[model samples]
Target: MRPLTEEETRIFFEKLVKYIGENIKILIDRPDGPYCFRLNKERVFYVSEEIMKKAGNVARENLVSLGTCMGKFTKSKKFRLHVTALDYLAPYAQGKMWLKPSAEQQFLYGHNVMKSGLGRISESVDRYQGVILYSMNDLPLGFGTAAKSTSDCRHSDPGTIVCFHQSDIGEYIRSEDTLT
Candidate 1:
């Protein structure tokens, strides 16, 4: 693994900022210790400074992965976040949407959330904004982009799509062998 170059950092942060906003500072400057992003085989990993030091000693070929796999950089140079990033993104998400119990199963099955399934939404969310999807009980289920703004949602039909599905925790089981 190696440190992300300036260009890579900019691209990665641009995508991350959409979901977490300015909280990116909190991620890098945590009270406990400093953490950073590293790249290995196009996949980005979030690792603590101390762990990064240790990892540096291992041979590159043998170090398959280290720390939390945030996501991967596609061949086209775009970043695609993985479900593993939910833990980090949930706490700092700027826009959030809660799913009704009845709709939870639908979302987990990789379907886009419909207006009828939405239990609640952050009033600040705008159309096409990145949003973290949660269960009624506040469990972070996944992340997606809003298909409609808060006001549009209130007036739209129940069948209208509210959030577009991206990545979800279910992916861990559905694609177990490919993760990491």
Candidate 2:
């Protein structure tokens, strides 16, 4: 694995900033020890410095992966954040949505969240903004983009889509064969 180039870092951070906002600083300067992002076979990995050091000794050709796979850079150079990055994004997410128990299953099945399934939403959420979805009990389930602003949601019909499905934890099982 190798460090991301300046252009790659900018593209990656732009996508990440949409979900985590300025909390990117906290990720870079964490109290738990230094961490870094490395690229291997187009996949970005978030690894602790200690592990990174050990990984450095491995031949690049033989190092299949190292650290958490944050996401991958598509052939078009666009970065796509993976569900594997959900744990890091959840804590720093700027917009959050909570689903009702009844709707939890629907979302896990890869359906967009409908107004009827929404239990609560952050006041600052805006149309098309990135949002982290959680259960009513506060379990982070996935991440998606808001389909409507907070104000718009209040007046929308129950069947209206509130959040567009992107990646979710359920994919871990449902698409296990396809995931890297």
Candidate 3:
């Protein structure tokens, strides 16, 4: 377990604040102790469970990994906010793409969504920007990138609306269900 270097800390904060917000700065002040850093790939850092605990009640048991992995990002490797972190994030993040239960089933299976499948969407999501995917009842399902801008998703009849579902709670449940 290695501590984050001063430079790494700065990079982490800059990247995280971009995805999340300035609010996350408070939690990473020291970037040591319970919080540990490991880089699985250059420019891709993984933060430990103890670090996540400081963010409030992150639901780690439902997650496959305790580490919150974030990348500097490219089209294929977009920024990811783990399901464990969603507990502390849903209230603060701006865009949530809410989906119906039926749509959620396919989505959990890694299917991209069409505009018709969205129950509701946030006000100003831009194309290619990441979004929080929410259940119809407002629970955070996971994270995704907007396949189309909010306007296009709202008005277009046949465009795909959310491309990569970065993570989802139902997918975890389904994976567990399969093991039995």
Top model by TM-score, which number?
1
**Model 2 TM-score (2 dp):** 0.95
User: What C-alpha lDDT do the candidate models reach, one value each?
Assistant: 0.93, 0.93, 0.60
* Candidate 3 RMSD computed on C-alpha atoms after optimal superposition onto the true structure: 7.1
Instruction: Write the residue-wise lDDT of candidate 1 on 47-131 in tens digits.
Output: 9989989999998878877889999999999999999999999999999999999999899889999999999999979999899
lDDT of 2 at 178: 51
Worst 10 residues of 2 by lDDT: 171-180
Alpha-carbon error at 2 in model 3, in Å? 1.3
Which pairs, if any, clash in model 3?
Answer: none
- Residue pairs with colliding backbones in model 2 are none
- Once fitted onto the true fold, the runs of candidate 1 whose alpha carbons sit more than 4 angstroms away are none
Listed in order, each prediction's TM-score against the native is 0.97, 0.95, 0.63
